[model samples]
Target: MNLKRFCTRFREMRTCYVGTQVSFLDKIFYVVDYVGAFIVHGASISDYFAYGFYKLRYNGRKEYITYRRYHIIQDKCNVLSNRCLCREKNKFNELFKNFLGRAWIDVNDVTEEQFILFCNQHPILFVKETNGYRGIGTRKIETKKQDVKQIYADLVSDKGAHYIVEEQISQIQDLAEFHPWSINTIRIVTIYDTLNDQVHIMNARLRMGNKKNSVDNFHFEGIGANINIETGIIDTVGYDTHNNTYITHPLTGKQVIGFKIPYWEDCKSFVVKVAKNIPTVRYIGWDIVIQEGGNFVLIEGNDNADHDFQQLHNCGLWKQYKSIIKYF
Candidate 1:
């Protein structure tokens, strides 16, 4: 958004345009189409052309419709900082306390003695910043070896007072086979229609972390694939941030397609219920992990739901919801 950043990005856009595979006319069309979308969304031209040249293949129509332009509208609709409720992990779990088990404690509120006592109960735990994003400020705690006081002290020093000590979730074996080291999560985006007072499952994708990482965030060098909303099947193999596709997981050799998510219907139903519960926050991106026994737990929620995953699916987001999104 600043002058330096803007210049750097514009330079990158021109570089990408030089390397694009599309014809000159097609590239011109892509640029013109993006200029129009920019008028509507004010998105950076660099990102638009970069995505268009590489991923969308200079297809102006898909570039126009698929690139999300609804954030301002979403913020206007979700007037209250109800969106911020989920931004803080402690407040998120507290708001939906009935849906989750007692698996967390605020590190700031407890003494070192009490924290150790709680840690001893679980072999593994996760110390996280209550309001972190993109899997940042998260530390995996192995209770067997690490000293609780040291871990607590480091967390408090690094993240200050607002952090949480949470029990590590065990992802379902079926899903874990793709990347055993990480707890992969399903990202479901839901939109609440204020006119109808109803919620809609806009889109979803399975986000898997690399074998080396513990957190499964799309931004953390992880992979994601589209999920068939109706069938609960993954539509394609995982793709990384670079837009490189994979038919099978590089580390685990697990087949991505035809893999049906466990407790699919239950996850959908529960997310819908949660969405309806938060009336003030109409649009939400829900991250959830399926347990070993086919049950699922809500990992976190995002009110600023971007269409990055949807863009990878090679479909225009607005094509399907033109009537509703026109208001934006």
Candidate 2:
């Protein structure tokens, strides 16, 4: 353990305790529980807070898969997902071309002339770093407002970072109406059981952009709600990073709790096929966008799927996860 980092996190957690109105006795009890969880369950302080282990209702807190344990699972399961084929944006597009459903070009692979043609073809483009996550290093470029030549020059010389430029996706009408500023997506986590040659849909969540942000990543202050895997209906209220809850979108007034995702069965089958295709990468978190006519497109795959957002409703999934993967 890094003592310096631990101290820093403790200080940050202390601020959260006070801000969240945790009483002094409760704070002391939580600290003790946190330390005990760290030693026994390999949980981080943030995991303790994020999983609501400090709350009275979470009596089975030990059943939650904390950050450190999630990493351990990733290490054991994602044997090949860390490779360039999945980790790098350009290579991922090449590997999963059939599902991308859009035109894209790698900055390093295209000449100025080819890039100019790409820009002319798509008025709105999403420029993203090859290995970026959580919406960092991503930009929405409107070709009509900016010079194509300048955009090409900047992309090529942006500190040696590789970028993949792709056409913007026009999401399904209902989702678009809910948050027109960003493309709301479904995050479906799949676990491929090698022993049984089966793909299991472990968990799913509906992520939506809040306050007109360009991305729906929870780290970007977006909201996420639990999706019932079998019914494809959102069953819980949305929650944000700051612990704020929403029954309807604050901006668009769309009801969140009972909204049904379009083409639900197709979405499930789509990811199962993808998971089977990459058997070596046993675990994956897939971001999918529903197109205007109910077709779904792949955004990206995460080998180290997040454990916090899926458990935001104070439900722990460690036992369910273990039963499926049996890694522990």
Candidate 3:
């Protein structure tokens, strides 16, 4: 809520919105959403008028401040609890141990010799931080690379580094055609139904990486589309991190809209099962990758899901999940 931070974030969000062609009407709606948040939280708008206003205000009623208060704090799920399950990618792999062929190892635990051996074991490997986000701390390591040792050292240097070595996931041919080199994944948002004691899929989106980035994160220079939850079909063309639009993929020229996600039912089932197992954290956003044969692998889970990504498509997640999330 610092004044400087608020001004900075306001400028950033406004800039992104303007670049994306967000209209005057939409901007006015953003103001209304901000006022609603201010009144609901029972705090002076000026107190949060800075960074908190810009960061959490516009997405939905259950945005930054509301999300932290209701989904996280009110649920008694602290930062440590969220990280133990969501932030660490390896924890998810272990949590769903039955899903075979997907493996991950921490660089700190393995010796230099073992690291090289692990690299050789897989044709293509993904080096990642156990607690990274936005695909910032990830690298693709090919076995053919000669400088594996130096790369390993740099990843595990004394600056107190933490890294995980994971196997590369292949997408189904149809999905891969959109972005072959990157592992395109489906991001499904879910909330636990306290009343019914069940988990439900609230909404879904498709994230496809461009040729420049290795991972498919919407905020990491990748393209994303809103998904039709019932039909498993992409509802729109992909948009980039900066809100730049794309109808045909820049690299492949493959049509982005109307693409159906394979193994949609199985993916939903797996996520529900996973959510049920982790009962303490009721809110979740899962990143699932569909394999070559349509079987999906769990990439990771997010407790504080980004509400803005859904809003980028000009739809609000809170509107879609109002009944399910109202109990929170």
**What C-alpha RMSD separates each model from the true structure?**
3.5, 2.2, 5.2
Compared with the true structure, the alpha-carbon lDDT of candidate 1 equals 0.75
**What lDDT tens digits, residue by residue, belong to model 2 across residues 6-70?**
76786576566436566778767777877887787777787777765666334577689888778
lDDT of each: 0.75, 0.84, 0.70
TM-score of model number 1: 0.85
TM-score list, all predictions: 0.85, 0.93, 0.80
lDDT of 1 by residue, 1-328 (tens): 7979865765466564545465778656655766675665454564465355334433444433333455544655575557778788888888877666548998878888888888999889987788889999888889999887788777667644589888877778888888988989999988777668777888889988885798878888898888989999998778886656788888888887778888899889988887877777777899888887767788887887666566554555755555554553
Model 2, position 159: C-alpha lDDT score:
78
Per-residue alpha-carbon lDDT of candidate 3 for residues 1-328, written as tens digits (9 for 90 to 100)? 7978865665566666444576778667656655566677532333233224445544433433334343433244323455567767667667756653477787878999998888788888888887788888788888776578997888888466578888877778887888877888889977776558787787789889897577888777788888888988888778865557888899999888888788888878877877776666677778888877667777877876765565555453444455555555
Clashes of 2: 0
* Candidate 3 lDDT score at position 297: 75
> Residue 124, candidate 1: how far off, in angstroms?
0.8
Worst 10 residues of 1 by lDDT: 58-67
Q: By descending TM-score, how would the candidates be arranged? A: 2, 1, 3
Q: On TM-score, who's better, 1 or 2?
A: 2
Q: What is the lDDT of residue 272 in candidate 2?
A: 89
